[model samples]
Target: MNLKTVVVGAGGISNAWFPPLIQEGIEIAAVVDLNIETARAQIKKYELKAVASIDLEATLEQHRPDFVIDLTIPEAHREVTITALQAGYPVLGEKPMATNMDDAREMVRISTDTGKMYAVSQSRRWDKNHDILRRTIESGVIGKVTAINCDFYIGAHFGGFRDEMSSPLLLDMAIHHFDMARFFTGADPIAVYAKEYNPVGSWYKGDAAASCIFEMTDDIVFTYVGSWCSEGCHTSWNGNWRVIGEKGTLIYEYDKAPYGEVVESDTTDFHRPLKKADITDSPLEAFGMHGAICEMIDFLKTGKTPQTECKDNIKSLAMVFSAIESAKRRQRILVEL
Candidate 1:
């Protein structure tokens, strides 16, 4: 079926969603934004035969789209999603689900009350290499996962909202890595102890660096160290990963393919022989935003739940908020979804 959707938010991020929607044969029934002209420009840019409106309710009533794609800023995510779900339209929204856990939970509640599917587009979860990393760990090549470490360093000078936020890196960016940790380990966050700071010579007004230690389920420890203001020797946007398990470890660094080594011999020697283990890319029809769009499409076609459905995604969001809270309290905080 050729699904029809009304996309909300005509900001830069919305651009990423449109092409994927078109490629999936999903019709752009309308574009809704706070600025009607911005919405109109988006429709024009895409050469879409869709109406542009500033009012979501009016647009929904007119188009009655099959679903709603929410590309709004994090602050607007809850409102947009709740409105769409309550109006009986399934919604696929951009990440960081909501500004706060209360709002995130309410969005999930509305979706359940309305019996509509509400999923978050955690774009990183769809990467082929990420899939491979996940599968490799699941394959037990590394045995029981004990610890997962990620280091993300970048010299980003984005002069907009990100530069002004208090916990810029933790709030705006680290959610992806946090979600990826959940994706790789199949574990939910248990507790978090974090330290958020602003480094000297940083351009951002708020803390652009953070070090977080998360206690995940199955006794797995996940540590994240990142900086948005680091000047040199930057890491991949996906960060460098080191996943340690009982039998061996998997290292994904410099955005290259992941590789590791495991004990080659089961001998009781003090130091057993080690052998190389490389991760092969798993087949994926699409990656990033396109992958998320495809998953939403599949969910609509079949009753299978999309991976980042609101209920499931809230756990990842919890990790983010918990870390922030931990930073504030200067103590470990329990992650409550």
Candidate 2:
């Protein structure tokens, strides 16, 4: 089947989405960005068959794409995604879903109301680091997943909305970890108690570091430490998770592309090395382009939306915004589904 595709953003990570579209046999209907020059540059760089357009309405009318990829900024997420859904187009956007929960809910609603597939690019769910973590737990090498802890700490000056004081590491980054925790444990969060603080040495109105403790059903727990403002040498393991099951334990460490490690043992080695498991020769520089390929293929054949659904990810998103609310209230807050 010929799937007509359009990519709606043309900056940094836009290149990452292309190989999948190409590999999945989707037609490059158009590539639209407010900055036509940047869009043209990307079109040239990737050798895509696309026309750059300045206006959304004009571009949509011109392309009439079967699917629209919203790769815009976090704050612009709802606007771009809702517009596409309202116009009867499915959206596979980059993540955080939306910068906040209210908009996240609205994005989900628009998709549901309009019958369009809306998926977040929570691609880490398909990463080998996470796959190993999931496998170890399923093998029962770890008796029962009693608890999980994750962290996303880095030192970078990506001066923008992210560096601002209003940034919540939980919202901006940890949603991946939060979602993965639930994915790995297969449990929903029941309640959350969180603490947030911004030492005088930081950049946003939001906390510099936010720690959240989530209570899942069956007595399982999730604890997260998230921060964008830190002096430490940057590090993370996608989920960077440690699971304490009834029988044993599983740990995964990530350093992004081609450098992640997982160590499964009852004891903890915070700075552990990547496991020598049977790593596959997945064409990841296609940028795990295959996840989007899987998504598009499923939508075309099964007519069922994939895991990135706003409805499904909204739960993980709730954990993120709830932690922020708990931070604001300075008390544990009950998460409202």
Candidate 3:
């Protein structure tokens, strides 16, 4: 099946997004961005059949793409996506689906109203290491998971949108971690309590650090920690994850390729090194172009809204919004998912 595609807002991630569209049976019908020059540059760079423009309407009318991929900054996410969804087109955009919970809700609402697929590029969910961890949890090597943990820390994001805003690091980057935790446990969070602080530093999102504790369905507990203004890239964005269960513990490091170091259900006594499992060599890394391809292929074949289907993302986003409310009142807020 040929996918007539329109890619909006040519940004850094588009560098990774374009090649995959080409390989995954998606036809690049148009490329839209505020910078006509950038659009033109992208078209030339990728050899796409697109005209540069700032207006989404003009591009939509001219190209009539089956889907619109919004890759613009956070503020523009809702405007672009709402318009596309209302006009009878599916959307695949970037994450934190929007700047706030209200906007995210609206996007989800519009997509549902229009009966179009709306998904975010919460691409880490498709990572090989995380995929391995997910499988391990399902396989139940650790008998019934009890707790989930993730760490997403970055030294700097520059003094821009992220730094100026007081949003918690957890809200910003931890959504992926949160989503992963829920995905691994196959549980939904019932409530959340969080603590966040913006340690004085030069970085994105003045709020430097945050810790979120969640109560998942079936009494599974999850804790996530994130910092964009930290000292160094100590942890992988996919996060070094640890899942503790009743009888065993599973430790997965993001730095490792097939980043799963699983301790089986009976072997819970000692913290020994994970002997790498020799299974089918996975092509799940999103480092280059494959991750984007994986998403496109899934959409084409399965017709599943990947980011939308993943329960962790919504919970992750809820965690962020809840933390924001909690920080303001200096009280633990209950997250409504």
Would you estimate the TM-scores of all the predictions?
A: 0.97, 0.86, 0.87
Candidate 3 per-residue lDDT over residues 70-89, each given as its tens digit: 88877888899988988888
lDDT tens readout by residue for model 2, 1-337: 6878778888787878877677777888788888999889988987888888767667787788888888887888898898888988888888888887789888888888998888887877777656655665665555667888887676556666676637557777777788888877788888899987776777666666778899987799899877677767556636356677665455666644222224544356665433433322333232354675577567857887787678888888888888888878888887765
Q: Over 4 Å off in model 1, which ranges? A: 266-271, 278-280
lDDT (tens digit, per residue) of candidate 1 on 1-337: 7799999999989888888888888999899999999999989999998988889998899988989999988889988998999999999999889888899999999999999999999999888789999999988898999999999999998887788788789878999999999999999999999999999988999899999999999999999999999999999999999999999999988888889999887998898899987565698868889998888888888888999999999999999899999999999999998
Every model: Cα RMSD to truth = 1.3, 4.8, 3.4
Better of 2 and 3 by lDDT: 2
User: Considering lDDT, where higher is better, how would the candidates rank from best to worst?
Assistant: 1, 2, 3
Candidate 2 residue runs with Cα over 4 Å from true position: 203-205, 237-239, 255-289
TM-score of 3: 0.87
lDDT of 3: 0.72
As for lDDT, the candidate ahead, 1 or 2, is 1
The candidate maximizing lDDT is: 1
